[model samples]
Structure formats: structure tokens, C-alpha cells
Target: MTTENRAGGAPAPAGAAASSAFRQPKAVWAVAFACVISFMGIGLVDPILPSLAGKLQASPSQVELLFTSYLVVTAVAMLVTGWVSSRIGAKHTLIAGLVLIVVFSATAGMSGGIGQIIGFRAGWGLGNALFIATSLAVIVGSASGGFAGAIVLYETALGVGIACGPLLGGLLGNVSWRGPFFGVSVLMLIALVATMILVEPTPRPEHRSSISEPIKALRHRNLSLTSVTGLLYNWGFFTILGYAPFLMDLSPLRLGAVFCGWGVLVAIFAIFGAPWLKARFGTARTLYGNMALMAVVSLVIGVFPDNRTAVIVATITSGIFIGNNNTLVTTAVMSIAPVPRPVASATYGFVRFIGGGLAPYAAGKLVEHYNAHVPFIIGAVTVAAAGVVLSTVHRALDAADQEQAHAGHSAQRADAEATA
Candidate 1:
């Protein structure tokens, strides 16, 4: 990919000036649609968490292993995605990922015990790691609306998937906890078929990426700092995502509705709110403020874990902060990292997902040993610390913004010359 494409620079010549983010080639839409289903896996189990615990005769910690197995495996598997995708190409990798998800999700649905489901989820995570990393790069490379637009499109898919996952889970889980699993299996099968048909085959990279490249890329100060901050932020993000349903004490359907509301806000802010905030406040200020606000929200959850209304309101409100952070942080990683976009994505995913994977299980354990308040309190501290870590990179953020502006201006000049 060109530097402009990788860094969210200028739009490609095909539709440089006229391309709206919403106007994309059929292939871009195909990957994006797959992204929606892939992301649904993150929250598809939320409404069913309580149900799973009871049905499987498992403790909260044992049930939380579903997330632990999936995410932790995903995090580790991120290391090899670039290696795998480079050799076989993006399209095959995506198909491989989708197939794993379909098979494992179906098996998970048939599982009679929590341990069996957790094992299957780990397999699902491996596929997720491959699909998630490659999809972002494919979208960025093929999208019409420039790098910024591509990121927005991707985040929109993420937000939509997250929002719909719980709603679908609740709607289906109302009948049986296994319904959501089968639902994912069926939806992904369709996505796999669509991908095979719509997305053009990608050529293998001239040079294969080594597994160590992502870890080596982390030696760069800006990328590592940004990734570490992400790790801290996710610790708080998943704590609520994983553990808060128990506190809500609502039925599966109602719990899904609550998270669906949260996911809606996540989508809205990521698409619309993030751009406005970044333009007005600048990326650093926007991220700092956003992270601090999320910290406050986590603290609120900590304070009133038992107050259903307070927990619900605070949980939903955190989505706004989460959405803004997701867009801005991802943009920052793409722009500031010195390595290739794929490498940066892999490194960032490797580090951040570890936190996301672990936080929920930790929260569950903390609740078992201490009280509900303790985990959220810890979550608040970590989020606040993320803001502090981010402050160290103000210069990097400014430089990235300036570089993107320069590229945008240059692209406009080129477009004018071509027209003339």
C-alpha cells in the first residue's frame, strides 16, 4: 500500500475529491459487512452470561472463561496474523478465520459443559485474530474515501456489530442460550460466502513478515506508549462489558436491551462524535479528556454496583467515551507508528487485547474474593493511568496530525492538476 493509504492520507485517484466515505466499492462493503459479524462475537454472549453460568453449572469465574479463552487466544494469535496473511494473502486468511468461527461456534452451541464451550471459544479467538487484523488492512487499502474515511467505515461496522450482537443474543437467547452461538455460526457462513464472491483475491506480499516483527515494532516509543494506553483503557472497558450484567439483575432480554443502548451510543460517537471532537480539540486533547471521562464513568460504576439504575446509566454512558477513544486512538496508531500499518495493527492488537481478555476474569475473581466495587475501582484507576501514559506522546500526536494535513493538501493539488 502507498504511504498515503496506510497513514490515512489522501484519497486514491479513483474518486479522490468526490468520494464520500459512504460511497465505496462493492469489495469494501463486503469486508465491512464481514467485520460487522466478526465483531459481534465480542458481545454476543453478554446477555447469556448469567444463563450460561446457571445452565452449565459453573461459577461466575468459570463462565467468564468464555471471554478469557476467546480474547486471550486472540491476543496471542495476533502475533502470527501478518505472517499468515503475507504468505497466503488476505482473502484466504479471512476465509480461514470465518470457517473456524462457524465450526467452533456451532460446536460451542452443542457443548454440554462450560469447559467445552471455553475450549471452543479459544479456537474461535484464533480465527478472530486473523480476520480482525487483515480486515482493517484490506479495508484501508481498498477503500475509496481516504484513510480517515476507511477508519470511520471500519469503526461503524464495529459499533453496529457490537450494538446488534446483544440485541440478537437477547432475542435468540430468550429461547435458549445456545441460540446466539448458532446465530453467529449461520451469519458467519453467509459472510464467508459473500467474502469469497465479493472481495477480490489479494496477492502475497513480496516480503513475508516474521512473527517477531510486531514485538520488535513495539520498541518504538510512540507505538508502544499508544498500545500500553490502549491496554489500560481496555481493562476498564471489558470489566463493564464482562461483569456488569450480573449486577443489573435483569432478564436476558432486558440485559441485551441495556447493552444494545450502550452499543448504539458507541456507534454514534465513533462515527460522528469522534471526528468532530478530533477536529475541534485535537487528537491528544480529545483522547486525554475522553479517557478521563471514561475513568469517571468506571468510578461511578464502582460506587453503585448494586444500584441497578446507576449501574445501567453509567454503563451506557461510558459508550460515548469508548467510541471516541476507539476512533481517535486507532487513528493515532495508524498515523504515529513508524512500522507498516499491518505491523502496527498487529502490535497494538497483541498488547491491547491481552488487557481486554484478562480484565473480565479478573473482575469476576475480584468480585468473588472482595466485592463488586473493587473491580470497577481498579478499572477506574487503570483508565485514568491510560490518560497519563498518553500525555507523554503529545509531540507524536501533533506530528501525525500535521503529516496527515500535508498529505491531504498535496492530494488536493494533484487532483486539481489532473482536472486541469
Candidate 2:
């Protein structure tokens, strides 16, 4: 449970005995703020989507596309953000993403139609993909050791932003649909300034020859399994969060309370559950177990929809697994390629982004054509497939790791014999 800093051969300070958690790095706080801002945009519409539908003459399908389009763009862009970061560095990416977010957010506020608004949302995603991937690099690069905790904390805090969005949006909905965007834009501007001032530029590693190398490395068990796992969780995670409000419009309690409940579960469990699961089971076991847990809950929701109580419970419980999904994925990618963890993280993000991108769009269409229930069904199937992919990848990676260990021992023995 303890880590030694490779820098000076010293044990890391215990988390419980930390003089302060806030002093790790200025970039840590900046990245945290950036996460808050990115996630705020996600949650900002939950309270108001139905209302926006009414005013914009948008159908449920149309409204959901807002999220779908953004995710698609983000997924596609995430592939290269790490490469771009390698060229320009994390600090530059963070600053640039912030600027684009600010401009696009302002444009979103002024958008005259649903199409324009969706386009603006896509712009935010473009900026956001760069911002998020780079910010992650910044946080990881900041630490001497023990960056995993910080990564989990970042994901957990994002749950808070998602949680707060509906409540804040609900309160502000009466003002205008534009109110949340404008307000979030203001907050983003502050984060941008704070990030620009506080985040020191770090040295960029030389571009690795042939970006294809990272993609090739992903065939290893860890990265491949985690990416599949991430995609599965995201597909289901959005199935619940992105579509729940629309689904809950069918219930008596309405969508606001449902989103609040879902968000709360994600935040609470992400903050508390992630570290416990990772520590107790070890990353691979936790990653494997949670996929099963998620699949069960998602199926339960699909099967028992008439019982609103069961549906709510199933939806919220899923968040517990989601809390750790990103961490598992990020950590696994790191093991796959320790030297260029940023590139590994991006590749994982990109793969999952593809899944997340499709979820909303596919779910929306399914809701329009088949029924609202169809989204969850497909999501459950996707998660099961993810389980298969993860299992295969994990087995493969463990074998490779063991092989490398044996090779290392052989090399050491030969060297010692030669010296003797």
C-alpha cells in the first residue's frame, strides 16, 4: 500500500498523514477545475433538455443528438490530442482548450436553433477532448509518485460536477436555456485564467516515431481489455445518465430528481468506492468484477421498468462500477506502456470515446424506433461483450508480463555468471 518515490528513494507520505492534499502541484488544481468545467457542460442540460425540446421545437431524438454529436467529435479528436500534447505539451493544450471552450460556450448561448446549438456543443467537445486528455497528462506528470489517487480523485470530482449540474440547471431553467451556458462560460473563463497563471509549462517529450507504435502496443492484454471495459461502462453509463431524464419523463417523480439521484450515486461511490475496490481486489480483479456487477444492474433496469423504484435503484447502483471504470482503464493503459502513459491513456480514451459517442446516438434512435427500453438492452449486451474482451485481454497481458519477468531473470543470471 505504500509507494517509494523513484527520485530520492524515499517512501511517499501516507495519504492519511498528509500535511495537506492541496499542495501536490499547481497543475493538479488547474486540471481539477478543467474537469469540473468539462463535466459541468455535460450536466448543465439535464434539467433543461425536455424544456429545451419544447421551446426549440426539438424532438427527444433531436435533443439527445446534442450529446451524441459532441461525444462523437470528442472520441475522434481524443486519438490525436495526446500526439498534439507530445508536440505542444499539456500546459499549452489546457490553455488552448480553455480558450475554445470559452468561445464556443459563448456561441452556444447565442445559437438560434437546435442545429446551431448542437454544432456549438460539438465545438466544445473538440476543445474539450484536447483539454481533458492533456490535463490528465499534466496531473500524472505532476506527481513524483502515487498519481493514481489523483486520477481517481479527478474522476470522482467530475461526478460532483455531473451531480450539481441538474440542481443548478433546475434552479436556473426558468431564466432561459442560455442561462446555464452563459453561467458555465463565466466559470470556464475563471478556470482558464487560473490555469494560465498557475499551470507551469512542462517539457514536452520528443515525438515518438510513428504514432502507430502506441496502437500496436495496445494489443497487450492490459490496454486492450481496459479500453473494451471503458467502452462497455460508458455505453451503459450514458444509457443511464444521458437517457434517464428522457425515460423518467415517463415517471411521476420527473427527470430532475432522477438525474440528481444518479449523479449523487456516481459522485459518492466514485470518491469512496474507487480506491477501496482498487486496493482490496487489485486493479485487474476489480475491473473484472465490476463489469459483471454493471451488467447485472443494467439488465435489472431493462427487465423491471414498470417498477420505478427498482429502475431508480438499478440506475443508481450502476454508478458504483462506473466510478472505477475510468481508473481501471487509465491504470491498465499505464502498465501497457509506462514510458508514454499519455499516449496510452489517449488511445484508451479514444476507443471508449467511440463507444460513448455511439451510445447516445444509437440509444436515441432506438428510443425513437423500438422503445426507450431498447437502449438499456443494447447496453447490457455491450457490457457482456466488454466482459469477453476484457477477460481475453487480461489473460494475454498477464502472460506477456510473466514472460518478460522470466526474460529479465535470465538476463540477470547470465550477466552474473559472466562476471564471476
User: What local lDDT does model 2 show for residue 7?
Assistant: 33
- What would the TM-score be for candidate 1 when compared with the true structure? 0.94
TM-score of each model, in listed order: 0.94, 0.85
lDDT of 1 at 30: 89
1-420: candidate 2 lDDT, tens digit per residue: 122222323333333212232356666776787788778777677777878888999987788877877788887777778667767777887888889889888898899999999999899889888888777766655643444455555675578777777666666665778877787788889999999888887677655324564476466555666777778778987776666666555322245556666777777666666556655565566777888888888788777656678777787678677766655565555544433556666778778877777787677788789876778887888887777777766654354333322322212121122111
> Could you say which candidate leads in TM-score?
1
- Candidate 2 weakest lDDT stretch, 10 residues: 411-420
RMSD values, in order shown: 4.2, 5.4
lDDT of 1 by residue, 1-420 (tens): 122553344434422312356788898998999999999999999999998888878988888889999999999999999999999999999999999999999999999889999999999999999999999989878886667778889999999999999999999999999999999999999999999999999889888989999999888898899999999999999999999998998888999999999999999999889888776778899999999899999999999998999999999999999999998899898877777778889999999999999999999999999999999999999999999999999988877666555534322121222111
